[model samples]
Target: MSHPTADRARQLLDLHTQPEILVLPNVWDVVSAQVVAATPGVHALATASHSIASTFGYPDGERIPLDLHLDMVRRIVQAVSLPVSMDMESGYGHPGDTARRAIEIGVVGGNLEDGMRPLGEAVAAVQAVMDAGRAAGVDFVLNARTDAALRADPQAPRSSVIEEVITRGRAFLDAGAPVVFVPGLVARDEIQEVSDAFGPRKLTLISVPGASLPARELQALGVSRLSTGPFTQRVALTALQDAAAEIVAGGTLPAGTRPLN
Candidate 1:
């Protein structure tokens, strides 16, 4: 019999190849995971480090202990049948070890951030993650990320930033990441340029609310995946805040609120 997680990993990998853009509304916990997995069209799930951290009362950037973070991931994996990927923020200072632990808990894939680390170091991190997947007998979907667009110097020319993104993105792909995530590159022309540089269906993108293009437009640009990084949780929290405010001001909870858990 096939390893269950291996099967899930393969299924997750296959989603990237289909003509439809793989849309992942990143979740923070079991309830969110269950809700997204229960959605009609969602094929897989991914965790948002920022949201997960917030849910646990910590700030982002891996402020939560590695053990604590992996514990949450383990619960999420147990809570859903769909393949789940983690946002391994900068690998928590040890890319390979963190991935190995995540895999041991049934996580089939993850996003590894570069954070504008040295090119050689970033490439090695990608290789380390894929290596861990191999040792675990799973084809991990490594969505290698370069924060070039986010970390770019304010005074730097836009072309230079694009150059930095392409440079790191190419290196990440060459090192075995299935897709390169350019998180802050939202413009049509720039998206087209990066997609062209990376060839069809090799680039993955993050959708910032009010900033990203529509899924159809991203698909037309030849992008392979669109991840809603932390926005899903943010939207949920926004609704919660509004509801709380209403209750404090003599208003009742909205009758339309759906119980997801």
Candidate 2:
């Protein structure tokens, strides 16, 4: 019989190839995972490293210790039957080991950022994570990320940034990552350019506030996934802030509020 983790890994990979775009609302903890999983039409769950770190009072970029991060991830993995992919920011400088540990904790896939590292080094990091997954008998879905657009020079031409994203994205795909996540390029033309470069259902993008296109339009452009990275957490916090302000003004809690945890 196939292992459950391996099965889940395959399921996540398959989601990327389907005609519809896989939309993931990134989660931070067990409760968030449970809530998203319980929602109709959610096929998978992804963790936002930023959200997780902030919940623990730390900043993002892997500021939280690996063990603590893994512990929280384990709780989330156990909380839902859906495939869980972790945002392993730069792999804590040990891509292989980190991937292996995450796999052991039942995480079927992950996002590993290149952080604009040297091409060779970033390719090796992608390989390391995939190698770890292969050794563990799971077809890990590595959403290899390129920060080219995120770090692009404002004075540089937009075409140059698109080219950089395509270059890094192809390299990561060749390094065994099933999909390449290119964040920060929200314009329709830019997204279409990168999506065309990567071919059908192989490009993933982060959905931030004011994204130009809806999920269906992105799917029409051949983008495979649109994940809300840390935005969900921000939205939740905004609601809390609004409610707290109302309470201080002598208002009771919101009428429609109910228990989710």
Best by TM-score: 2
User: What would the per-residue lDDT of candidate 2 be over residues 107-205, giving only the tens digit for each residue?
Assistant: 999999999999999999999999999999999999999999999999999988899999999999998999999888799888888988988888998
TM-score of each: 0.98, 0.98
Collision pairs in model 1: none
Off by over 4 Å in 1: none
Among all windows of ten consecutive residues in candidate 2, which has the lowest summed lDDT? 206-215
**Number of backbone collisions per candidate, in order?**
0, 0
Query: On residues 11-95, what C-alpha lDDT tens digit does candidate 1 reach at each position?
Result: 9999988899999999998888999999999999999999989988999998999898999889999999999999999999999
Give candidate 2's error at residue 150 in angstroms.
0.3
* Model 2 local distance difference test score: 0.94
